[model samples]
Target: MLVDSHCHLDFPDFENERDEVVARAGEAGVGLLVTIATRVRKFPVVCAIAERYDNVWCTVGTHPHNAAEESDVTAEELVNLSEHPKVVGIGEAGLDYFYDRAPRDLQARSFRTHIEAARRTGLPLVIHARDADDDVAAILREEAGRGAFPFILHCFSSGPALARTGVELGGYISFSGILTFKKSDALREIAKGIPHDRLLVETDAPYLAPVPFRGKRNEPAYVAHTAAVLAETIGLSPEETAAITSENFFRLFKKVQRPSMRSA
Candidate 1:
């Protein structure tokens, strides 16, 4: 069975087809999906999607791009919101220097807040680090010193240095559809070095769809394509890749109940 560790079903791309999108994921052997939240105030929309799907789960926290807007959302608020049964993680937060949609300082501050919540709840922090590798690694290293917390570098497309830092801290590395792009050989080489138990897969859907589905509207069902390429990059069969990543997903996101894989 497979698990899409990060996606945004609440996004408008899946509006009228949410049911079909999820069904397709199930038919593609994806047993579980964790739709991420990008804004704290709009969490109800994200939460409602999770509540509507038995096999779907969610997180609570703001993305770095919107850090400035949600600058006031406290760590305590994230911890409290994460108490919901369907909320399995703490964030899709971290730095995004490429876009610089929010000020770097605000992004760093917001990242720390989410980290604190992760530490308190024992739920994994679903991180998204882009071109700001140095700051992201520094913050992670600094915060981890206060007390270790579980986290996953979601949609990993950064430098090897950051990947190494995350692994050294015992955090997981989740690959998205970007892994299947033809020009991602360097990224594939990084994936090869990660410990098998620390590897994960996601779609980050309504965005970067994998090859064969590239240029198309992404959905959880396409995570399998990403997994296939990732398996090839890491020298494992697709089925084996699925099992390992699914196990890793459950291991890190302990708040989520592992779904039965009778059909998987």
Candidate 2:
């Protein structure tokens, strides 16, 4: 079984075909999906999707782009909201200097707040780091100095330095459809150096689809393509990639009950 560690299922892009998309994921051997929340205010919409599907789970917190608007969202509120059985992780939040839609300072502050929530809740934080690798690394180190928290650098497209820093801090790195791009040789090299136990796969669906479907809408089903590329990059078979990443996912997001391990 495979797990698409991060995807925006609540987005309108999937509204009409959400059910079909999920069914396809199952057909494609993806046993689990985590629909990420980009806005705390619209969490109900995200949580509802997870609630609707036994194989789906969700995370709560604001995206860096919406950090300013949801700046009022506190760590305590995130902790409280995460008490829901279906909400298994926290934040698709981190610095997004590439977009800079929100103030960098506000993004950093929000990132730290989400870290605190992850610390408090013991749920893995799904981090989004774009062109702000330095700040992201610094904040992660500083926060780790205070107290360690679990997290994954979701849809990683940063430098080797940041990847090393993330791995050193005991954080997992999830590759998205971007990994399958022809020009991602450098990314692939970095993946080669990462410890197998710390590696994961995601589709970031409704966005960056893998090679064969690069120009189309992505879904959890396409995570297998990303996993395939990751396997090729790391010299593992596809089945090995699936088992390793699924193990890594359950290790980090301990709140999630593995489908096979759940009570009938």
RMSD of each: 1.7, 0.7
For model 1, the local distance difference test gives 0.94
lDDT by residue (tens digit), candidate 2, 59-156: 99999999999889999999999999999999999999888999988999999999999999899999999999999999999999999999999999
TM-score of 2: 0.99
Candidate 1 structure quality by residue, lDDT tens digits, 1-264? 999999999999999999999999999999899999999999999999999999999999999999999999999999999999999999989999999999999999999999999999999999999888999999999999999999999999998999999999989999999999999999999999999999999999999999998999999999999999999999999999998998888889887776654235
Poorly placed runs, candidate 1 (over 4 Å) = 261-264
Quote the lDDT for 11 in model 2: 93
Q: Candidate 2 — number of clashing residue pairs? A: 0
Model 2, position 255, has a per-residue lDDT of 82
Candidate 2: pairs in clash: none
Query: How much lDDT does each candidate structure score?
Result: 0.94, 0.95
- Candidate 1 has a TM-score of 0.98
Model 2 spans with C-alpha error above 4 angstroms: none
